[model samples]
Target: MFTHFEPALMKFLRDLQNNNNRDWFNDHKQQYEDNVRTPALAFIEQMDQWIRLISPHYEASPKKVGGSLMRVYRDVRFSKDKSPYKTNVGIQFRHEVGKDVHAPGFYVHIAPDEIFLAVGTWHPDRDSLAAIRDHIVIKPGPYLDAVEHQPFTEFYEMAGNKLTRPPKGYDKEHQLIEEIKRKDFIAICPLNENDLYQPDFCKMVASRFGRAQPLQKFICEALGLRF
Candidate 1:
């Protein structure tokens, strides 16, 4: 019974971008709840069912706090631009074993003029990075198939930071040396606003995730995690 998100979600975020202060957000909190949070939670709830079928190890939580829907509040403690709230809506259906954003997961970013779906680990720990590189060396075909073949290739493009030179152990002449130089194992697909307006939005997401399963499974195998 899941449907499309209303246009208000983007409208609210755009407005928030202009008036990013706490007072402005507080005044419009009800609108946020009604148009953004509520719809987002509903989407997550439906995705909870869809993700189980896609991968039992993953979760699409609908909790008000500490769930798939990321917090609206921004942690500006370390940065100079102390904006109290984030202008974008982020939803991550992370692996059950993952404790933080660095874990392997499907990420959805919704914002005005910037919308995309991403998958895999972002900024993984040193050990995890090494393991992924090792896997790429040992099993290059699957990696190639996942990226070069249909379904996955049709949707996503390899993204994330890359090392200018090959890593310590990997040889520069190696076929996948470029891939091995990656600091992140992330892939992303750009999405349009009309896509979100479709009634079968959840189904479309599930389909895309299924297409990316081979890549996810390979990463999980490398990390000794179930996909």
Candidate 2:
């Protein structure tokens, strides 16, 4: 299924690592599409099915969630620091765009070396903040046991925006000014270079997605392997 993804995913990671810039990323936009964008969507499509089983209080006819790269340019007019880009995947769980209270979902960071996913009570149509607040407040375990058995493990919080972790206290160690806005997280198990997409690992991940039934089904169907 990810036949079109392997090549581009490989190249984009290589390019992004050395000289990261808007122009650099834009130049290889198509590569990003072939690898990251396309495959991410394909993956998220499977993810949505899982979300359905887990979050029943969702919009019945919701829009397909999407994954996108956060812009590198930070609007300095409001603040001073200008990070060219964020190195994590940010997804919105909604039917469409144009709203701040998008869907609830998670991200996977290629750097600081982490992989995982999570969701809160975010439903664009009904309760956006409520969903997020609930998830963050309860402190749901980011890494499920099944997912932990995979090749990668979800690690400590990535960019402060993913979700709220233990309070930073007065140290102000985190980068983001507004942290509470983020409300969920996920981390994968460890993996070796030669051990990607292993059937056992994939099956374990599929099993952990118990709440996300639709998504689990999609994965099962994709590999012709069932949980």
Candidate 3:
């Protein structure tokens, strides 16, 4: 029984962008829970069921802490701009064995100007990266077909940084060299703010992810895992 996202969710995010401090967040914690957090958790709960229907190998945790809901707190210890909170809501449905963003996963990013639905591995460890590149080298047809599929290509384009030169062991002139040289294998479909206002937004998003299943499955197989 999911409903449209509360309009206040966007308002809260806008406010957070302006006032990215703990004091401001503490003052508006209730709004965060009622307008943003609670609805987001409900969406995640429903998404968990929807995702399982597509593939039992993937999971969406509804927990407030370590679940799919990314923490609002920004890790500014290493960064120069020390904004205390993120101004967007991020939800990820990832492989059960995946520990972080590195694992093959699907993502929903909700923001004022940069909303999108994405899938793929981001910054994988050395071993995982090698596995993916090796797989692309051996059998690139499926990967090519998946990314170039009209339905998928209509919405998403290949994303993330790529190496200028071919990686070690990969041919510089290989047909799939560009894809194999990618540091992250991700695709994103930009979204409109109005899209979140639909009552069937959850199902709509799930369908988009479904269309990308071939790519997800391929990435999983390359990593020696189920999709």
Error of 1 at 157 (Å): 0.3
Model 2 ranges off by over 4 Å: 1-11, 58-81, 92-112, 119-196, 199-206, 209-227
Mind giving the per-residue lDDT tens digits that candidate 2 earns over 144-227?
332233322232222323434433331234333233343322222233322224434333333443434333222222223333
Question: What TM-score quantifies how close candidate 3 is to the native fold?
Answer: 0.98
Write one digit per residue (lDDT tens) for candidate 1, span 1-227: 56788899999999999999999999999999999999999999999888999899999999999999999999998999999999899999999999889999999999997999999999999999999999999999998998878888889999999999999978789899999999999999999999999999999988888888888988999999997
Candidate 3: C-alpha lDDT: 0.90
From the highest lDDT down, the ranking of the candidates is 1, 3, 2
1-227: candidate 3 lDDT, tens digit per residue: 66668789999999999898999999999999999999999999989878997789999998999889899888899999989899999999999998876778899999877999999888888898899999988888999988999988888888998889899888889999889889998999898999999989989998899888888988998999986
Q: Between candidates 2 and 3, which one is better according to TM-score?
A: 3
Query: Candidate 1: misplaced stretches above 4 Å?
Result: none
Candidates in order, TM-scores: namely: 0.98, 0.46, 0.98
Ten contiguous residues with the weakest lDDT in model 1: 1-10
lDDT of each: 0.92, 0.39, 0.90
